[model samples]
Target: MAAPMKFHSLADKIVRTRVSSTLNKDVKQFGKKHLFDGDEETCWNSDQGSPQWIILEFSESLSVSQLDIQFQGGFVGKSCWVEAVKSGEESFARIHSFFPQDINQTQVFPLPDTDSTLTSLKIVFDSSTDFFGRITIYKLDVLGAS
Candidate 1:
C-alpha cells in the first residue's frame, strides 16, 4: 500500500467562511462550520446537484502555500477547482484544478509559490459522485503566512 502525503501548515490561521450550498434545514446539525470543526464524522453536505462552492475570506492578505481537503466516500467531488482573489482584486483567478479519486481520504495539493497577497479563497465543486449528486466535504484547510 502507498503511504499518504503529509504537509506541515505554514500558518495555523482560521478565517471567516461561507458555503454556496448547504444541506436541507432538516439536517440542522450538519452545517458549513463542520468543514473546519476538526471532526471526521461531521461534514458539510450540499443540498443536491453540483456546482457547489465554499468561500473563505481573510481579514488580511495571506501568502498561501498549500491546501488540504478531506471528502466523504461516495459523495466525493468528481471535478473541482480552486480560485483566489488578491487583496485588491474584485474577481477570483484560477489557482488550482483537480480530480479526486472516489474515496474517503485526505489529499493535500501544493499551491503556486507566486507569493501573491490573497484575501479570499474559493473552492468550486463542478460535479460529484452518485447519491443525489451531493458533495460532502469533511474538512478544508489552508496553509500559508500573512
Candidate 2:
C-alpha cells in the first residue's frame, strides 16, 4: 500500500526567533507577524527606504522545496533576492533573485533540491515602487519537509 503524503510549511512553524527589519513605525498594523498568519487581507509593510529585509529562522533544519509569497499592489518588491542558511552554517547564501511585478497576487517559486536542510531563510528588498520604496507582503509560505 502506498502511504499518503504529508505537507509542511516552514513559515507556519517558524521559530520563536524575532524578525528584524526597518519598517515604518506608523504602519503598526502591518507588522511581521501578519506575513505568516495565513491571512490575505493582512500584510507587512516596510518604511520607505533601501535595503529592507526580513529573516525567518526555524528551530531545526527544513528540507525546503518551494516558496510562495504574495505582494501588495502598488507597494511591491521591485528588486529582491532570497537566501538560505543550511544547518551548521554560520552565514546565508544567495539562492534566488527576481523582480516582483507591481500587482496584488501570489507568486510561487521553486527552490532547487539539496541534500542538506536549511535552518534560516532571508529575503532582501533592494528596491520597491517608484514612489515609496516600501515593501508590502501579504503572505509567505515555505513548503518543505523536516
Candidate 3:
C-alpha cells in the first residue's frame, strides 16, 4: 500500500471567511465558526438553497493539498468544487471537484499540487444530497504545510 498523502494541518492560519448562509443568525448555534471548531456535535448548517459557497482566507499564502470533511448524511453536498487564489491575484483557479457520499463519515480528498502562494480557498456546493439543498458539515479541514 502507498503511504499517506499530505497530512499537515494548516487550520490555524485561517483568518477571515464568508459563507452563503448559516442555519441561524445566532453564532452560538449552527454558526460558521462551528465549521472548524473540531467538535463532533457542532456543525455549520446552511439554509435551504442551492449553490452554496464557503470562502476561507489564510493569514499568509498557502497550498491546500488535502481536504478532510464530515457531513451529516442527507444534508451533505452531493457535488462541489474547490478553488484557490494567490495573493493579489484577481481570478481564482479551480483546484478540484468531487462528489461526496451521502453518509456521516469523515472523508478525505487529496487535491492536486497548487501554488504555495495561494491566500484564499473557496468551496462551492453545486448540489446537495438533501432535497431542499441544505448542508450540514460536522468538520472541515484544509490540510498542507502552512
Cα RMSD, each candidate:
4.5, 3.0, 2.2
Clashes of each: 0, 0, 0
Question: Could you tell which candidate, 1 or 2, scores higher by TM-score?
Answer: 1
What TM-score would you give candidate 1 relative to the actual structure? 0.85
Quote the lDDT for 53 in model 1: 88
The CA lDDT of each predicted structure is 0.79, 0.77, 0.86
Q: Give lDDT tens digits, candidate 1, residues 73-140.
A: 78888888889998778999988888888888888777876667888888888988865778888887
Clashing residue pairs for model 3: none
How close is every model to the real structure, measured as TM-score?
A: 0.85, 0.84, 0.91
Model 3 lowest lDDT segment of ten: 2-11
Clashing pairs in model 1, backbone N/Cα/C closer than 3 A: none
Root-mean-square deviation of candidate 3 = 2.2
For residues 1-146, could you state the per-residue lDDT of candidate 2 as single tens digits?
Answer: 97754556776567853344536574468788788888777888777777778888887788887778898888777888888898888899998787777878788777777678888888887888857677888888888853
Best by TM-score: 3
Candidate number that wins on lDDT, 2 or 3: 3
